[model samples]
Target: MGCATPWCLATLVAIALALRSGYAVSGLVLVSGYYFPTARTDFWLTSAPAMPLLGDLMRYTSPPIISWAIMPKLMRTLFAPRAIPPEFKNEFPISLALRPKQLRAAAEESAFLIPAAAQLRLQYRVSGVQLGSCMERLTGSSRPTSRRLHAVLPSSLLHLVEDAGHMVTYADAAGIADAVAALAPSAPVRTA
Candidate 1:
């Protein structure tokens, strides 16, 4: 265990030197103090003292190890912005449809239904359910369009909608099972 400290230090020094010299290093190193060969008695006695010195040097270079090591790469990736294509932007005419009150009501109603739909796998049965609320909140008219989409969805899909809030009532569960059974192909007839 104590030996691993020196070995780890040596490894970090090598990495720092290599990185400074424009070299690359990869793969993992394992160091154990207690298991297999003991670090102090086995590795230290067998290896050069300079190895531990390098490890110590590496340790002194930084306090927050993650900040010194990995954060730069992550920060670079995250802060770099990208542009969205024009074709992907919203063009659904949400501004012309719903009033503020209707939009708010639809948003609340959809919020209640979205989780239930997810829990019951209702999305697999129904298509065009807009689980997004941001647009409705921003435009204050998109809620009616969202509700219309939900309301006009086929009975096959609507059968999964539970009256008892997000929970699937016993009746709803039975109805879903029946609907699934009706849609499932009949087993081929068997003749003996």
Candidate 2:
């Protein structure tokens, strides 16, 4: 629970924060790619291309239909008076996504400060999948690559799980558990 796996582009900001802050974070388990604070081209070139028919196919599920299916459970959850933190309660996840320039600024600031804190840091590991065969990766003209990851996290351990995709946890939970155990021997691994 204490460790964090900042998924996708979220790793860009999270890593910057961890490096900039003086706190000795337990670890960062990066899932998928670690986005670098580079130009928009760097990101766009790697993303999947959108096709018209596929786009329509992806969005074909009606919102009302989805609401009808899940609204009752959602309402039940919302009705519960949970002591959630203010940040969690009020925060919109989309608001956290940073533009390339914003990401660059954070990276520059972090790069300057990281040297001072580098010696005091703890474990930082990365894990990616063998195949991200979902529509997004499948549609992309070029194969998905973590070309920038090495430059960003040169010292961190990297793990590639076989037969996994963007939804790595669902594809291979046991592999993830094994990776965690390998990273931190004391970490508990629950099997169902």
Candidate 3:
């Protein structure tokens, strides 16, 4: 599955940038970010808290309850390819993320990505222009995203970094920083 640090928000920002708002956005940075509006089996589980009327009530109920059972695996999965820090294990605000309200936000944001990506896909002209497209090194399903984006935007840069998966910023901060620095108008700077 593709992701983002809340890709729903990223999709919104992409929309804004596409609209050419007062603010300028050079590119969209995705971390485990999903591009297509395609469905995932997990969608129902994560997006359930986003349902109208029931969404509000569901948060304090079954979904969150079930999530508690899965959080350890979820946390481990999110931090894969790297060990979870002791700081995160000992002191991070896990409860805050597990809070009902937080679940609601996550659910809603996850739900928003599909339509948003669809809109972004539709916005691009078939004029053979391109955007830089980088994707995570994980997820078999995610591999097609770059290809699909490249198909639409033929000039898209496909920079595939090995093991660039969920929570990769933490896994390789220097690499991430270096990647960002390289994207700058100026020459790349040392990020480590």
Candidate that scores best on lDDT: 3
Instruction: Please give the lDDT score at residue 148 for candidate 1.
Output: 33
Q: Rank the candidates by lDDT, best first.
A: 3, 2, 1
**lDDT agreement with native, every candidate:** 0.29, 0.37, 0.62
Best by TM-score: 3
Off by over 4 Å in 3: 4-12, 18-21, 126-133, 139-142, 186-192
Question: How close to the true structure is residue 50 of candidate 1, measured as C-alpha lDDT?
Answer: 26
Candidate 3: residue 50 Cα off by (Å) = 2.2
Misplaced by over 4 Å in model 2 are: 1-6, 37-147, 186-192
**Steric overlap count per candidate:** 3, 0, 2
lDDT, model 3, position 62: 79
Per-residue accuracy of model 2 over 84-179 as CA lDDT, tens digit each: 335534562422323333333333433433232233223223322211111111112223334334334555555554434343444445655665
Model 1 residue 127 CA deviation in Å: 8.0
Assess the local accuracy of residue 63 in candidate 3 as a C-alpha lDDT between 0 and 100: 76
C-alpha RMSD by candidate, in order: 28.9, 15.1, 4.5
Worst 10 residues of 1 by lDDT: 133-142
For candidate 1, write residues 67-143 as lDDT tens digits: 34553453332222222223322452333323333333333332323233234333323432222110011122112
Q: What ranking of all candidate models by TM-score puts the best one first?
A: 3, 2, 1
